[model samples]
Target: MKNFPLLIILISLCIACKNAKVIIDDPINFNDQRKNLTLAYLKNRYGIEKDDPTIDPRMIVLHWTVIPTYKKSFEAFDNPTLPDWRPDIKNISGLNVSSQFMVDQNGTIYRLLPETIMARHVIGLNHCAIGIENVGGTKNLPLTKAQLKSNIWLVRYLKEKYEINYLIGHYEYTLFENHPLWLEKDDGYRTKKTDPGTDFMKRVRKAVKDLNFKALPKN
Candidate 1:
């Protein structure tokens, strides 16, 4: 009977674990390029055109900022125009790439846009994918443990909130080239990428394997 209080505390902790981390709303400039890309994404994603900018969010695509710090990452995304370096991609949507959420090195998650909105993070799957960008992934700066935990929590939270079908790393996105989720309009718009590497993704998948989401189909 004396252990009843301990049991109650344990139960309370379990309930608390169910609660999600706070997602800070740190918006980027929703410029004209972003607006047009949103419509284009909607058209490709749903095969119909609507006035609003939204997505079905069939997949979650993870990325790494490669920019070292969170503020620099935000600055890179804050610019309305696509970076001048990628002429191939800018011609298609003029919209600079961005993600729905980003996890800082310390595990703090920031919501750059709504969950069901389109982001230009992945090439072929942007129309139906949710992008989660982490702060670091350079050769010198690897991702941290805190970021991993935050990503696990974030992925689970998103899965519960939406009908997420697949969870993939940025590098694995090309594997879906002929699959139904691949919706990029321009075939030539593809770029070589290696952000948020295999090891990070393996850890994330191992943590969230119980969610029972479908694995990437065999190519």
Candidate 2:
């Protein structure tokens, strides 16, 4: 306890320096171990019957946390229980639910959880969706270009790794509401959400078009 102040100072410095966009070195090393953990999570929470069978990913869900930093975002996902208002999560892993990756304003991407794991980021599609959360989407701290590039790079990387078909933003998740993408058991129940903004998602979608995850245009 005596070194608490020093510990905090050190932590602050480390955080101040953490950046997710360090050239996005090609072959960012998929971390198969982490990927496997994600896969296990998908099965348990979303009831994805098979992993080896080419799991054709149809959508990529995007999000933005009103929360401020990476550590806080990490802490949010690290736990197994979401906020009480998140009734959508209680029926699933009981974990708070987090995205596979989070991009901070500085363009630093942190792998809070594994992609293979079905996170509770989106409703009705946790099993086959990839969730990417941006650090801040609030009025005080809007999205950044660095974060945009990082997202593009990360999306490209994931597309190369998986057989993903559609890329989606959290806001658009509801548009597909009552649609066939609701293959997961949690197809019903819960309210609507719009995250990372429709415009931002459109930009990301354009960047990842090569991956073939684009949804229909907004009406």
Candidate 3:
């Protein structure tokens, strides 16, 4: 009887894992206005030799959109031009930054862009990195436990789907300054950022430790 109970619990867990879902609520598209801009940005900002924006992802970078709600986050990235506040880089390329996936407060995962297509999320690594942005992390709207679970699942999913090797937070992105993944041509065009918090990353790393993804090089 005791062994039967354990078997039932194991079966239930397997069923739950099998039925796990990450819905695609919205997708940001490259319309007539945005396509040419994206191509120009790819070449000017990242110095990509080819016209194609497709990327063979080598790393996964996580971010938290301080923009409280999913609607606003989507609206903010809908346009292809950089916001006026960022005058420094706007001159280089009018590319508005975006990510591959976004996790809302309730854990709904949205695909903003294609995984193989480049997104201007991580400054130096957009050429070979995939970015996942969470909906809320500001002082007013903090991230939820649901988002943490979603991120853990998403990371594992991406690793299985792609040739992803390194998993890093947005803040840790600067560590790749001189690494091959860092594709920016200008040495001075760097921004300091701390996002998705240290604790959040620690928890994610602990959860996905079994995946055996490589850590950022110390050099």
Clashes of each: 0, 16, 0
The lDDT, on a scale of 0 to 1, for candidate 3 is 0.85
- In order of lDDT, best first, we have 1, 3, 2
lDDT-better candidate, 1 vs 2: 1
What does the lDDT read for residue 212 in candidate 1?
Answer: 87
Candidate 1, superposed: residue stretches over 4 Å from native: 2-7, 14-20, 31-33, 41-48
TM-score of 1: 0.90
lDDT of 1 at 40: 72
**Where does the lowest 10-residue lDDT sum fall in candidate 1?**
39-48
Q: Per-residue error at 121 for model 3, in Å?
A: 0.5
Identify the candidate with maximal lDDT.
1
Each model's lDDT: 0.85, 0.68, 0.85
Record all residue pairs in model 1 with backbone atoms less than 3 Å apart, i.e. clashing.
none
lDDT of candidate 2 over 61-108, digit per residue (tens): 778987787667666666454567767546654455667678888888
